[model samples]
Every structure is written in C-alpha cells, then in structure tokens.
Target: MFSYNSALMKHKKIHKGEKEFICLQCGKRYRRRIDLAYHVRIHTGEKPFKCLVCGKTFCFKSSLTSHERLHRREKPFGCLECGKNFSQNIHLACHMRIHTGEKPFKCLECGNRFGQSRTLANHMKIHTGEKPFRCLQCGKSFRQTANLSSHMRIHTGEKPFKCLQCGKSFRQRGHLASHVRTHTGEKPFSCLECGKSFSRGSNLARHMQSHRGEKPFKCSHCGKSFCERSKLRTRQQIHPG
Candidate 1:
C-alpha cells in the first residue's frame, strides 16, 4: 500500500508522461504498478472489490469506496454558501461559482463568459452555426443536444415538469420555473428608473423603453413606430389574444 505522499508523487509522474509500468494485454503504459494492475483487470474482466450491502462488484477499491457512499446516503462534498450537498468534489466546486459569480470559462469568438465549461462549449455552437443534434421524428436539427431531447418530448407527449401548486405541467423546466413565480408572486425583475418590479426581464426592458421614449418596434404595414412592441403588434393584428 502506498502512503498519501507517495501516491501523490506517483500521480505526478503521469502528468510528466513517465510510464514505468506497461500492460501485458493491451500494451498500455502506467506510472504506477497499482494502476497497471487495475488496467489488467479490464482485460481479465475481474472485479475483486465487492460491495457488502448491494453486492455490486467494482474493479478498483477507490471505485468501491465511492459506490458505498451512495448506499450510505452520504454527501461528503457540500457548498459553504448555499448549504447544498453534492456527491463529488467537482460538482461542489461548480456550485461555488453561483455564490462567487466567477465565470472562468470564456468564448474565444464573442468574449462571452460562463461559469461552466459545458455552457461555453454550447455558446460556441451559436457562432459556428453547427446544428449537429438532429431529431429523427420531425427531422429538425438543433445546435444543442438538450433542445433535440426537448423536441422529442413533443412527439412523445411527455410533460416532465409539473407544478406542485396548480398541478399544471410544462414541457420545459424554465416554463415550470416561470409558472412557479406566478403562484409565489415573485417579481425579481425591476425597472431602475421607476423602481417598479416585474415578474419577467422582458417586461422590465419594455418598461424602460417607455422612460427613454425609444420606439424600436415598427409596423411593417404602415411604417409606424411604438415605444412598446405590444402596441405595434396589436395594431398589426399580429399579437396573439
């Protein structure tokens, strides 16, 4: 058994690209002999570490230890700011950004920032115009895989997000969140000029236009402008009742 300090030293060798041990079955190189032994089990299909509670078998002792935590219902990693618990340290680290407002990941094209690497990757697709995720049912393509998954629910008639208060279901979680605000009477968005709060950010933005007298919304039929988009939409008969 290697000590904690010895294990750290051995792990550093991997980052340095120093492979001391080689796998006999696959010719894969490993810095530590323990790691080489663990790799060999993949070829042999050997799971020596067994869970006493669930009877689940794992190839590595470390994997077994992590699995046992699930049975114990223990979340070792916790956020200090929110009191939220996570199964892994990486998840807890990601959660910390919510309180810190630290956006480490940034887009190279637009210089837009995001807290998570996955969000930055998704934003890159907007600039690239790469819609790889395709729906088989409708043959519609989406930039994000999550959008395609949500689209599939339309064909399946699956309303996953249910409102606890009114029992009304929504297709998307954001819609459910907005629906929840209606029940709670939570108006998070506020106009800076008038100090009047609104439930949605778009409502606040439209209200701000009134103070500035900026008529961005134009009617295509008459070339008439209005401070609020709702006014132009109403005149054009385009606004849904």
Candidate 2:
C-alpha cells in the first residue's frame, strides 16, 4: 500500500493499465509526464546532461551518473556466480547468464537464442543486410555502430587495444583476446572429431574440414580443390595472375 494519497492514485493507474502522458512526435505513451519528456529527447536529438570526466553527453541525469562511474573505474555491482564486477546492475544481470547459460531473447527469423538483447539486435541485421553505420573515409558500411567504429581505426591507424605480455597493440578487442591466449597457451576452441585443440577458432574450423573432406577453396585453372587457402595460393602460382 502507498503511504501518500498521491502515490496511491499513481499506483491505481498501474493496475488500470493507464498511460496519461503521450508523445506527439512518435505516439508513444508513458505513465508519467517526466517519462514522456525523456522520450521527446530522442526525436529532438537533445542530450543536455554531460559527463565532466569524458565530456560525453547523455539524455538523462541517471545515465550521466552511470557514465561517471566508468571514469572512476568504480564497479559497485558484483556478479554472484563468478564474482565479476560491473559498473551497473544491468551489466551484472547480463553476466549471470554466462554461468547459467540462459538465453531469454530468441530471434523470430532464425529461431536462434541469445543471452543479451543487444546481441539479438545485432544478429537481426545479418538477415536484413541493413548497414546503417558507414565509415566516412572508405565508404564502407557496418550493421552495428561498434563495427563501424572499429572499421574507422583502419583509416585512423588507432590501436587502442593493448597487450600486457608483449606491449603489442591491436585495432580490435577480439584481436587482443586472441593475442592473450598465446601468453597463457590457452586453446579454448577444440575439434569434436579428433578432440584436437587450437588457440584460435579459425584454426579449429579449418581442422574440422579435414574430417568432413570439405575443400571450400578451388582453383579455376585445372579445377583442383584444397581445404586450406594457403594450398590454393600455392596452386594458383602455376596459373599466374
């Protein structure tokens, strides 16, 4: 029960499924007037809230508070399963799915499930082939904004991802993760056919083809085929470019 009369009235609206405030621009309805005000910022492209640490703008003050924690390297929320820390409670919730292997979001198109909604959204673009984010320098497009941001590094030569082992740098985070496996001798990927392990997933995939007798790479010269591209390259030399 609500303590105040005003709060009790607001609680009744929740039960009645009533949304008094509605946005004129998008026709989206909100329970409270303040929520509708926040929704309007999306159409107007207005982000008044700014982070002092990184100078990043946000639409809401609550978002600014969450962004500030990143600058201080403060992870108040901790995962109970693995004891992993996260800056926000939402991130900790997402991490818990790893331990339980829970996939709540399912793609209607492919029937593939994902632990996170963002991943499901990213996967949806693969079917549509809609590349909205484009690189200004090379005119190359990417389905996700993160991919476009990573593609921009090719022209800018920005190697932000660094390794502690050899002080080596890479343009992408995945490259850094693979490089880290080298120092630890961690072969996470394995072949089911032979139980053979490989440091990289690409290596494991190529190894799997040997068991299936699949030669994906083919030569146009004499109609010869090989499982590995390197062998195809060697065979292509006889034909000449």
Candidates' lDDT values, in order? 0.89, 0.93
Write down the TM-score of every candidate.
0.68, 0.74
Against the hidden true structure, what lDDT does model 1 obtain?
A: 0.89
TM-score of candidate 2 versus the correct structure, residues matched by position: 0.74
lDDT of 2 by residue, 135-190 (tens): 88879999989888988889999999999999999999999999999999999998
Instruction: List pairs with backbone clashes in candidate 2.
Output: none
Which ten residues in a row are the worst by lDDT in model 2? 79-88
Measured by TM-score, how close is model 1 to the native structure? 0.68
For all candidates, the clash counts are 0, 0
